[model samples]
Target: MIREAIEAFASRSPSRFAILVFAAIIALFTILLSLPAASADGTATNFPDAFFTATSMVCVAGLTTVDMATHWSPLGNAFVFLATQIGALGVLTLASILGAIIAGRLGLRARLMAASDTNPLRLHAGPVAEGQAIRLGEIGGLLATVAISALVIEVGVAIAVLPSVLATGYGLAESLWYSIFYSAMAFTNTGVTPNVEGLTPFAHDYWFLLMLMFGVTLGSIGFPVLYALSRNFRRRAKWSLHVKLTIVAWSALWILGTIAFLLLEQSNGATFRNMNPGEQVFQSGFMSTMARSGGFALIPTSELDSASLFLTDMLMFIGGGSASTAGGIKVTTIAVLLLAAFAEARGRSSIEIFQRRIPGDVLRLAVSVLLWGAVTVALATIVLLTMTDAPFEFVLFDVISGFGTVGLSTGVTANLPDPGVYLMALVMFMGRVGTVTLAAALAVTQKGQLFTRPEERPIVG
Candidate 1:
């Protein structure tokens, strides 16, 4: 009966399952965290703080109303780590894995839901195999591969960082633990640090920062890209245009952001004044990469120059790739939009990339995602500005950070009023699922036009 109900509910719509899965995880964590045992002093965590923390962790946003180090007990931290892992893996993917494990099979509706929840864009790009049910063995195999690959990457990163952590004067056991925690946090792009100073001590440590940067980049580059690269390594398979576009866009954005940060913050006494040239370059690169939904910061976000902050806001909005742990409008969406603009500027009728023409629907969807994201952030900025006396820049930064799931803040998160916290929480939720998916989830039902209307043109800008 329980399984039947789940199947029925999942059949209703993919968004329902995705939303419910995240909702369940958040609720469970919220209850667990609200217990007195979850706190350091044995005092119960208030509902507001618990809810906000739980939402942030489950969404992998990493924003905190209270410090994890000072306020939360070991048990609470464990809960947060688990929730972050779940969020990073994705609610739908994890849920499907669990279902496959327990039932030894996934129903047709379950597979469809899993696919839709993880990559709805794929469904749009291709047709589902007609009258063919997805095999349970196939899903189980894929799930196993993804899970083992992720574990291996994370564990390898931990081992690599362990020595550097010990060099910092941390005790052996503590260093080992911290290395593992940092590896997990980096790969998940949660940006939450168990360390009190939040990675500040190792800002100039080459090995530590490099390893973390690699981990963050690998995780946020999207799993599909990784899988494709892996397959190509073994079989020399042809690369899809999607894979090419993602890599190109990701690399371009990282380079552009790094240069922008370096130029903007070169003379900012608070951040880059004392740093040596090499250290500044590394820090600038790290910040550039992290700003695009990785969430780690070497320099204090508050100390960044206005230009650097504004540039960061744009990077955070563009975000990482689709179907990855990272959030924002996604690299592919930005790439598509840019391609469209370039095509229009060249007086071309179709947007062509790598000799492939982008479908009209795909372009439309990309525009919708970008527009919706902008509107959401704008509205959030207005709300935060009206509710608090915080600076406009800080409020705007916080809003975009939440919506990007990047977790970088300008020191305003902890002081936000209750209403503001809740508002940010909502933004985090939407971001985790994605602006497009959230829009789909809120839709009443899927409907298509039965007849075409005559096309008309409106006045141009």
Candidate 2:
């Protein structure tokens, strides 16, 4: 009976099915988290706080209404860690695995569903393209590759992080636990730390921060990108345009963001004032990396100057790569928009990059994603401002961070009322799964017009 229900649910449009799965998982976790055993004080948590935390965990957004180190018990922490993994793996990946297990083989419908959810770019490539055929095999291999790759990377990072954690004078068991927890959070890009101050204590520890940066970078780069690299490492096969663009955009954002942060925050006494040149350079780079869809912070965001906060908002809004643990409108969407503008400036009819023409459908999808994301963030901001005393800038920061699934906060998250907290959760869920899936789902429903209407011109700027 249960199998029948799952198969039926899986048969829906990929975006709707994906959203349903995420919502169901979040609901289950909310119930588990609201239990007395999930709290440190041996009392049941209020529904709003529990639901918010559960949403954050399952969305991999890392925004918290409660303190991570002090509020929850070991069982709660375990639940959070597990949810982070599940969220990062995503509903589509898990569903693919389960569907294969239940049916004893992956059907064409199931493959298309998983592919559409995880690698929507393939769908954009159209039906007769090699990408569509490749995706069928890719999804099957992705299940094992994603799970094993994440596990191995997390374990390796944990081992590297253990010595630093132990040197802080924690006992062996405690140090090991911290190591594992940090590893999971960093790799999953959830950014939930075992310490209340996050990575502040280890801010100067370059080695520790390096491992985390490595893990987060690898995780947010998208599984398809990584899989392509692994599969084509020694071969003469050409990398797909999607993989190439993702890598280029990913690198460009990190560099540009680092430079922007360094310049903007250089004079902020509360942030970079005490740090020397080398420390400043490293911290700026780290923060820039984290701002792009990473959840942890080494410095208090509230202390940064207004310009820096605004800059951080932009980076958070851009987020990380597509079809990965990271969220946001995606770098590819940004790339498409920029390329379109560039093409228009050159009086070209079609945007061309790397000898490939950008599809009109893809451009339309990009526009839709940008528009929806902006609207979602704006609506959340308006609601939070009305409900809480936080300034518009801080509220906007929280909203973009939630929408981008980048968990950095300006110390306003925990102070919000119940309505504000739920609003943030809605934005986070929408940011993580809702926007991307919704965009793709909407795109699939669009049919090319067979009949033409009279063309009209509107006044332009």
Off by over 4 Å in 2: 121-134, 234-237, 439-450
| Residue 227 lDDT (model 1) | 62
Q: For every candidate structure, what is the RMSD over all alpha carbons to the true structure, in angstroms?
A: 2.8, 2.3
For every model shown, what is its TM-score relative to the native structure?
A: 0.94, 0.94
Residue 50's C-alpha lDDT in candidate 2? 94
lDDT of 2 by residue, 180-222 (tens): 9999888888889887666777877889999999888988888
Q: Can you tell me which runs of candidate 1 are displaced by over 4 Å?
A: 98-103, 122-142, 234-237
How many Å off is the CA of 11 in candidate 2? 2.2
Query: What lDDT would each prediction earn against the true structure?
Result: 0.80, 0.82
**Global lDDT for candidate 2?**
0.82
lDDT of 1 by residue, 220-298 (tens): 8876666667656555336666677888999999999988888888888998888888878888899998998888887
